[model samples]
Target: MSLIMRPATEADIDRLVDVYFSAFKENPINIRVFPESSPQSRAFWKKNLEGDLKEDYVRFQVMETVDEPKTIAAFAVWNAPQKATNPMPPMPPLSAWPSDGEVDVAAEFFYDIERQHKRFMGPLEGAPEGSQQRPHWYLELIATHRDFQGRGAAGALLRYGEQQADAAGVPCYLDATPDGRPVYTSKGHGFREVESRLYQGGAYEHVFMIRDPRTSA
Candidate 1:
């Protein structure tokens, strides 16, 4: 099987969103946040992906199998340091959402998650201090399509980001789910857990990890 990794473009948004939705549809955090499998959930995710693709500070990449290049096997989204006058823009307005009611419900769920995160992390300390003080690469999302889980596509995408981070002389940061912790801690990435927090009323816990830039020997 031939596999390729490349930067994602606007034309790839739908496939990228599909990969993300399929990978996270059953995730504990996504289930807790979205709750329902509806057009609204799909639309929200699609729009979010679109917005990410349009942002100058964001980078989106996808992995595809050569036999079916149009089908995304995995994807990763990241945020680079932004210029002082060009901070990351806000999410699309409510009117752009698919359904007002669904958006409201999702907003409340996200708020709860944020509140829990803040409570566990403490004010202004959710991320590592070094990352806050310096320009760093932030991994916003990474997922492998369910059918492609065992094939190492996720690791490939992660290493791509690490190479970029190393080239920039900056650390890389990501929030990991329970199932993803092992992968992030494995040899190549050198990620260390900086914080952990339980959510969903104690049903789950998320891990925050960072990989410091490699120093020349």
Candidate 2:
């Protein structure tokens, strides 16, 4: 099916919420990590992203088949040059910590902190060796419906985001959950060990990740 890609609008909020939940339904780390976050982690993310648009820090996008305007198969949330204005827990420590056993503990608390660090000091979040500048844009969220995982839908979304970032002559940044890390890597996103954390719901473990297209080929 051909997808009509466009910037999300207010009318699209509900569907975007559904798409946001559906795409991130299984990713708990993405759900947590926000300071002063709520029990309804999913709800928090939905409201936070949509609500934060006021700060001009958010840019929403959707991929929909021509047949269903109410149904969104994929979505991307981008953050302009601004701080992550949401309630979130403190960032966990890196390497110095141990694992929580074979159950795949959430080893990404430090990841969240790293993201916060980026919020505080863009391009200096984890400050690469001799790194002096921060990327121009950031990706708050990105996902595709499970049914369309392997499709080029995600790349299409990223391309849209890239165009936005490229227009500003800056690189794009983001935090990838566990599953997203590899995907981002394949797309040339570098994976750094930030903080690891245990999400309350399923106790899902997640790692913090960053992506910069500038340094990538």
Candidate 3:
């Protein structure tokens, strides 16, 4: 089936959230961190996706099968450069999630995971003082619908970011799940692993990788 990619809007939030959750529902680390599958998880994902769609620096895109144009096959959340604003914000508090006790606990558990991620990625997040740093595109999240896993939708989204970053002469960065690292490293993409860490007390590992601009000279 043919696929088309386009920017996702607020109107697409519900479907996009479904794509996100369904795509990651069986992911080992995701299950380990948020297993209860409560409404709180749904609400948290909705709020986060909405915030991303509203952010000027974020490029939210969805892939749809041309055969069924309304069906979202995959989606990507990318962070590009924006002037006059701080793109990085503090992690949302657990209180921001739904008030149910289970949801609150799930939110807290994921927050802990976020903290661990920061600890592993801190050095890459900034550069040494007095050194110039080139802005790079960040691949925050990318997932294919469970039914569309092998159809190349996710790679298309990654290539979209790569094309933009190449044109602008910037690198690309992502924290890849074990299932995704192979795709990111294949097809001459040239992503190199810089760090790897186990999450949820060694249940799963996330690999941080980077792809330098092919247009760099």
Candidate 4:
């Protein structure tokens, strides 16, 4: 079955929420941060994604099957290095997240990652939407629908992000889960693990990786 990658639109949000929950249903971070297993959980995810979509530097991309009435097989949320002409607004503090979403656990996990992000990439600067010292494309989130995991849809999205980073002569970065580290490091992906850190107060961990831009000889 053929798969295609393209920019996701508002119309795709509902389906994307489905893809997200279906894909990450078993993930540790997903479980810890989004503990609600009810309809309210789905609603929270949808609202969160909707907010992310409205941000200037955030880009939502999807990979879908080629058959008619195509299914969204996988999706990625990327944070492009901000341009001065279109700077990103500050994000709300984790404290502001709804209690139903397990905001405390999410804050613990995300704050841990933010510590690594700042140490390795430098703090984010508002002037142009990039790190103070090292600018790079950040993969904020990615998920493959359970039915399509083995079919390479996620790889296509990774390659698509890599192409964009290569075009801009910048590195691509991500925090890879235990289940995702292998794929990120597989041949052709070029990601090298730079650090491993525990999150959720040692309940789980994620690996930070970077793939430097390919240069012509």
lDDT-superior candidate, 1 or 2: 1
Scanning candidate 3 in windows of ten residues, the lowest lDDT window is 81-90
Pick by TM-score: which candidate is best? 4
lDDT of each: 0.72, 0.57, 0.74, 0.78
- The total of clashing pairs for model 4 equals 1
Q: Write the per-residue lDDT of candidate 1 for residues 11-99, one digit (tens) a residue.
A: 88777767776788787657654544566767777778888888877888888888944578999997775532332334456565556
Q: With candidate 1 superimposed using the best TM-score fit, by how many Å does residue 211's alpha carbon deviate from the native?
A: 1.1
lDDT per residue, candidate 2, 1-217, as tens digits? 6777887766766566566656765554443332222334445445555664555556777887777544677888776554333322233333322222211233444454455645533444565555534545666668787766676778787777676665666666655566666666664434344554555554565555444445334
Top-down TM-score ranking: 4, 3, 1, 2
**TM, every model:** 0.79, 0.62, 0.81, 0.85
Global Cα lDDT for candidate 4: 0.78
Clash count for each candidate, listed in order shown: 0, 22, 0, 1
Per-residue alpha-carbon lDDT of model 4 for 1-217, expressed as tens digits? 8999888888888899888888888887777666646665677768778887897777788998889988899999988876434323333577555566777776777776766665666644454454254567888889888888899888888887788889899888888887788888888898999988886668787899989898766
Off by over 4 Å in 4: 83-92, 95-98, 123-133
Q: What TM-score, to 2 decimals, does candidate 4 have?
A: 0.85
Candidate 4 differs from the real structure by a C-alpha RMSD in angstroms, to one decimal, of 3.4
RMSD of each: 4.6, 8.3, 3.7, 3.4
Best by lDDT: 4
